[model samples]
Target: MRALGGLWDTTRGMTVLRDAGYTPNEKHVRRTYRRLAEAGLLTKVQDRPVQYRVESGAV
Candidate 1:
């Protein structure tokens, strides 16, 4: 996300939001990734932890 910019896993993304006081849960994180990826706004890395990176300039 804009917080760190480039390559991050679910844990990292959740951590970033938590650190910012968003209180987003695991399901929320997964939903975000799923929605974005489904919308073609995110690219899911076929890794163990299932990382996702948002496509910049995407709606």
Candidate 2:
């Protein structure tokens, strides 16, 4: 969650997490993103590749 918190304004992609020190694979992050989206704690932006942002005040 620290990673997400620190990236509040940035649209985070799986690759960003990997580059930012997350140890898990991209698939793991993708799954977690999906769950968060379903829970309404995050929003997924569709584009060339999907990206995510934590909901405002969700933390």
**Candidate that scores best on lDDT:** 1
Off by over 4 Å in 2: 1-22
Clashes by residue pair, model 2: none
| Each prediction's whole-model lDDT (CA) | 0.79, 0.64
Q: Residue 40: error of model 1 in Å? A: 1.4
Error of 1 at 58 (Å): 2.6
Residue lDDT tens for model 2, 1-59 = 63445332223455566687876666676787788889988777654466666777675
Clashes (backbone N, CA, C under 3 Å), per candidate, total: 0, 0
Q: Pull out the clashing pairs in model 1.
A: none
Q: Indicate the residue-level lDDT of 39 in model 2.
A: 92
What does candidate 1's lDDT look like per residue over 1-59, in tens digits? 64456766778878989898998888888888888789887788767788887687665
TM-score of each: 0.73, 0.59
Worst 10 residues of 1 by lDDT: 1-10
